[model samples]
Target: MRRLSFAIATLLAATAMAPLAIARGPDGPAAPSAPVDKIVDEGTNRSEVMRVAQYLTDVIGARLTNSPGMRQAEDWTQAKFREWGLTNVHKEGFEFGRGWSAKNAGVKMIAPRPLTLIAAPLAWTPGTNGPITGQVVLAPMADEAALDQYKGKLKGKIVLLTEPTDITDATDPDFRRYGDADLDKADTFQLQNGGASANRRPSSASRMAFTAKRDAFLKAEGAIAYATMSSRNGKLVHGQNSQFQVGATPPLPGFEIAAEDYRRLTRLAKMGAAPSLELNSEVSYDDSDTKAYNILADIPGTDAKAGYVMAGAHMDSWAMGDGAADNAAGVSMVMEAARIIKASGIKTKRAIRFALWSGEEQGLLGSMAYVENHVASRPVDPALTGTNRYMNWSKAFPIKPGADHSKLAAYFNLDNGSGKIRGIYTQGNTAVVPIFREWLAPFNSMGATKVATGRTGSTDHVFFDAVGIPAFQFIQDPLDYGSNVHHTDVDTFDHLKPDDMRQGAIILATFLVNAANAPEPLPRLPLASEPKASDGFYAAPGAH
Candidate 1:
């Protein structure tokens, strides 16, 4: 999953609760169908979910989109889908940027008491040809305005990117499951008084522009390399870099150092010790294909006119860890669901499609491209290029539905972690609450209970929900994902729980079958329209 702010994490929408008690199906309170029992048996007794995760994470390694690893993952997933008797298995290509991976990276202090530091190269950034030795400088460059202050002062220096701050103790446990109180809190509806775009920070466009300009300045000033402090207190490093487009690649080698090591370097530099450091970043770029592909396969339905239901997960991850808890878990569950359905010989009226999206870490690029190509689209401003287009797309007007707009019954996403299914965020689609409750009843004993009216963002489901499709992300146990493993060096296969994976697969398979054969398509939230200005002090008379 992409990183999210507190606002996006707790984002909520209004709900019309009139339909909460009544199921939409013509038959009252639909129970788990006979197919669900078969799905559970297959997913529980004959599950291969752990093996799938092992192959994807342990074998494939980190799948940076369009890189060699990602290409291998796309091909392997399609092969697996075909091997399981899924029909129409293929890869759908989308315009993405250059792919990059770190071959090797190291940083160590050479002067003022030698010490080795934990670090990794920032993704999509250039690599030093070999080891580069230079004196460290605490430049603390934040934005373009600070560039003028360091003019002609950074020559042959390893610049520390941000000011070091004292680390604080964590307030909450690193690993946790949803307790009854937590689920009850989630079930309560939190009313949103204003528009979603209320209090905002600088746009991503401005950030990207500043990053490109800053990199150019650094290179022109003869800086040898740059290092940034890790966000967490532990020796955790997340090699996150977003300048991945063809023309916008970063100009200088970048590394993320462990927080404690970075602070020590900062202290040394502050005391005028003039610490010297040796840096080496061995990396490569793959420009062989500018396009990334999303792996897709389908189970054909009996009726041609009936629409399709889908399950999806991103198959891309950061360069650091094996990408296990972040998304390989989700991918494994999605694959296991498909295998279970096929193996159980369950038939449905509507087709079921399983999708493995790529370029998700960068910004829901693959899924958004798929939505634009086959689901729905709105006119985007030509000036909004790269990530900006996706960041600001929900504000676009006059959404135009594609031929498959209505044909898509629903899309369910799984990307939180290797956590078990706790519940689901309904995104305030009131009409589906009762139906979902019915669908979730079978898993009550497995701890999948709550059906919240709140919403969450920063995943592949955002675009589908924005375009008025019935899309949702399940609420999963955190289980050290947010605290210790998410995008960190420890996000490996060891953190995955086999029982959680099996539970998720069973629930996913059951939900897909229910939606596929439902009497009617699942309800959709209204299509987006331009929202009223949140802070209306300078508003136009009729701007809405």
Candidate 2:
């Protein structure tokens, strides 16, 4: 009887210390370093990455910013975060233009041969009122200067928008995983001397101006329709256009034809056949909501004063295939990363926010809006309005930081197709190199090792980095994303590598947790100033 009473007392004492055991010294419920093994097991042994990818790509289909598919994606992703018990799960909206969708599209040759061709309608362009039949005209125009040459002769014609270039043989393998040598080469530091600045193409402003002018000219000339040759060598069609703004809706219908088929039409035209074609582009516009949304959810931190760390992937894609490799893969990984972190039951000192950005295909509009609204602000040039404001906003001076500018501890992005996480691009933030090295060490055996100091632009991270925030993109394997997929009709769910996606999610979760618990926020780059011309060259219009 005496021993039994002592055992009951001991049990009561142990039960009283349970709360103390979980407390980790003013940091949070979890240890200072994230539990990497737990993350890996959750990400791998029971992965939901593929399921998420399938739903986003196969079920949701192409997500062109404010399109119906994109709206569905936003709702579905928010539902997922709430299901996972993530806090602050809501969408932030910004002023976007119109949404577009292709109901049905087809192009067929009627005269030379009754052969149907692979084609897709360009986004934000009008559809043919109905089926329009016209003779094909090879009126290749590169700029507005060339538009005058075909001014009055294009009536009742389907104009070939670009000249056919000689198809080149593939030099590198279409599908490739990085070898040790490739990773080593990528590790070399790049100089910021801006060597390629001397050979600049026309600014985006000029290019857009030409696009507006050319579209007006074609419509004024009574052209029935227009088609552009695919830039890719394979018989893939990517329906890409940038006329989504409210006042910038293109007047005439446009389509992108497979390269081989385009070349055949060009050859027939050169041979004096004048291959007659029939086009039917049934599309619609949705102006019900001119605002595109960014999906945001958070795992609340123990210390609100400690800033938040973030992970993001663009949820919007071009209107082509399912947008799997180009972005849905990345989106799945980010979502899975958040799931893994929440499921691991680890509490961080600072919050961890997951963002699924929209309008990324339309010049990183969603992320740029986030930076401008929450993190920092720079005065936009009054002269550079419209799309030019987003394109060249980095050129503006004196960045004005917002209330939460310093509260963003660090941001990591993943958008380079469905390749495995090889490593990370440091984006020239030398101070964070060693910190990333420590966080990435746990996954070294999983093939994520290198930390490159190169700058990769054109993704959602550009605007954040431009504002001196510690933002970065991962280095992924160069799987056919550049060769055949990316913006092509073949960027479907079949191309995503499941193993790579799982590894990427595990790595992303580890980084976010580690950054959240770190004693200090990641170092920031020096605030940007007006850059001097590298070669005394001025590419902007009217610059002397």
lDDT of 2 at 440: 78
Residue pairs with backbone atoms closer than 3 Å in model 2 (clashes): none
Return the lDDT, model 2, position 308.
95
lDDT of 1 by residue, 33-106 (tens): 53555676677667889889999898998998888889899989999999999999999998888988888889
* Per-model TM against the reference: 0.92, 0.91
Taking the tens digit of each residue's C-alpha lDDT, what string does model 2 give over 1-544? 1122232233334433433222133345434467766776677667899999999998999999899999999999999999999999999998888989998999999978899998889998998988999999999888767888897899999999989999988889989999998887766666655423313434778888788888889889999889999888778988998888886778788999999999999999999998999999889899899999999999999998998999999999999999998799999999999999999898999999999998888778899989999999888875654467776677666789998788998999999998988899988887777777867765666678899877888898988888888999999998888988999899999999887888888889988988898777888878877656556465797666
Residue 503 error for model 1, in Å? 0.2
Q: Candidate 1 has which clashing residue pairs, if any? A: none
lDDT of 1: 0.85
- As a TM-score, model 1 comes out at 0.92
